[model samples]
Target: MNTRGFYDELADRYDLMYADWDASTTRQGRALDALLTTSLGPGPHTVLDDACGIGTQAVGLARLGHRVTGTDLSPRAAARAAREAAARDLALPVAAADMRALPFADASFDAVVCADNALPHLLTAEDVRAALAETRRVLRPGGLLLLSTRPYTALRRIRPTSEAPHVHNGPDGRTITFQLWHWHPDGERYDVELFQLLPSGGTWTTHTSGATYWALPEEETARYLREAGFGEPVLHLPAATGFHQPVLGARRPVPHTRSTL
Candidate 1:
């Protein structure tokens, strides 16, 4: 299935995949906030969480007092994000929209964030460029863009059969989340089956969803950003940034024109 349907099916269990979902929100929010403050010069600025899944970043940023908007391909995810924002008393505007073409007017946001390896969802260089171009279109001149992705350089070297499962125990008992990857021979694309196993009374219940993504290396990500009209993209590591994944910082430079002699 496509990403929208895959995520839609897992909306209820998505949060369960994380060890400490609420803590992750705060941590991720702070990391993005720091990048924004340094690259975009302190906000109170309008921000867009383009691939916001269940308000993880949106609501947290809103809590920090920035105006935020969120959008996801899945209607169910977007609705959950909005509801989660409200539950936290943060008013965030979220909708179901494709990342390739955002519904906002040109130059609308001061900054844009696509966290949690969102860009690779496109699965092709052309699609990735289209999404980046659209992101650039909605940003104000000199806008900051923050993105995070897995370090595929290492990932590609070890084409593992499966990822380590994230298992958590709660009042309901145990919930185990993991992914199985079927890599394409090209080495840059993988079909991912996300599985969530939950304790159902006496036995365990399993739910599976599948999707695909292109494995984006830092080099390719930077090249596409520049091709899409972005300025130099700076790479930030988790060691330096305290973020879950490696981050990239880029800017929409001011337009320049030749002067008449």
Candidate 2:
């Protein structure tokens, strides 16, 4: 299925992957806040969540008082994010846009975030570079860029097939979710099948979705960040950040010139 269709199928139920999804937004938001503050500074800064999905991070960041705008390839997902924000009485401007090509002015934001393993969705080096270039273009000079993805360094060798099932209560009843990963021969790409067993009246119903991602390692990702105009890219492991995935923190370099006699 196409990216938009695949996410559209999963949008309404996406948050069920987490236990207490709302609380997770706050936790992830605070974690990102600490990272942003430690590197960028303490204050209300403008942020763009380029691959916002259903606005989990965007809403949380908005609650934290950061001017946040979000975009996603799936129109349904973007709309859902807007509704989610509104439900919380937060104003989060979410638009439908591809990460590879953003529709925003240059240097318009203090930070650009592509969290929740969003970067890997681009399966090729060129595609990743294009998205990174756009992300850097939207950030002000010396602005921060944060991205999160699975620890492919170790995950690559393991080639994990699935994750533990996450069960959550839905409007009608309970929902059980899990994913099965199918690795490509190249070892750098994987096709994932997301399955959900949802409650329907007295019986359970099964729904499935598909997606592909590049198993881009930390070293290669950092190199791509530099190629895309970010400097001093640093890899932060989950153990250190208390996040589920490793996050890469980098910044746009401020232009400087030496005085001549």
Candidate 3:
């Protein structure tokens, strides 16, 4: 499926669908707030919300006194984010860009945030690594990188054929329909697809377009972080915070000279 259109169609109603499903928008907002505060220190002025969807959390960060730049693959979603920023009388630079290759210069932001299982949208380990590399490149030395992914144990507990209705509210004040398709697990990776139904009653299906996730254990994710050139990552479990089941906080290493150089 073409995820671009799927998200574009749901851009206006993204919030409503999640509220109906009992998803925690407030908790997510707080998690993002805490992440920004912890990583960039108090009162950060600049931030990047990668895969920012409709700028929900981006707005929250801005409300907390940060200058936010939000990016997403869907143009409609980006526009929605821009409108939301305007409504709040905040300055948000919303752009449509790919996660694997962001349109920014090195050390461009004080911090980068990719929440809501955004990492899983990339289908392979290479994609994940590339996204991380890009994120690291855009962050200042000693900058913070905060991200969340599904726990492997949780993924293991679910069946491949399981179906769930994930809803979102569009800017037009209508509930958007989304159908989730879960596939059998393959090694550490699993496949999932999202389908959006038009409010007019017809189904407009977008294929996963190679959507996959590597359900990395906390240890594995930390190892990946270290390999990606970040400092040691601190793991936070859901018990610590009512947000993500497991959150990883890592810092980009401050540049150092090699003795042999």
Q: lDDT by residue for model 2 over 1-261, one digit each (tens)?
A: 767788888899899888779998898888888889899889688999998889889988999999999999999999999999999999899899999999999999999989988888887788998999999998999999989998898899899999789989767888899999999999989999999998988998999999998998899899999998899899888778777789999999998989999
Model 2's alpha-carbon lDDT is 0.90
- Greater lDDT among 2 and 3 belongs to 2
Report the lDDT of model 3 for residue 231: 93
Candidate 3 C-alpha error for residue 124, in Å: 1.5
Q: lDDT of all the models against the reference?
A: 0.90, 0.90, 0.72
Weakest ten-residue segment in model 1 by summed lDDT: 36-45
Per-residue error for 129 in candidate 1, Å, reads 1.0
Per-residue lDDT value at 217 in model 2? 85
Candidate 2: regions farther than 4 A off: none
Score candidate 1 by lDDT: 0.90
Error of 1 at 125 (Å): 1.7
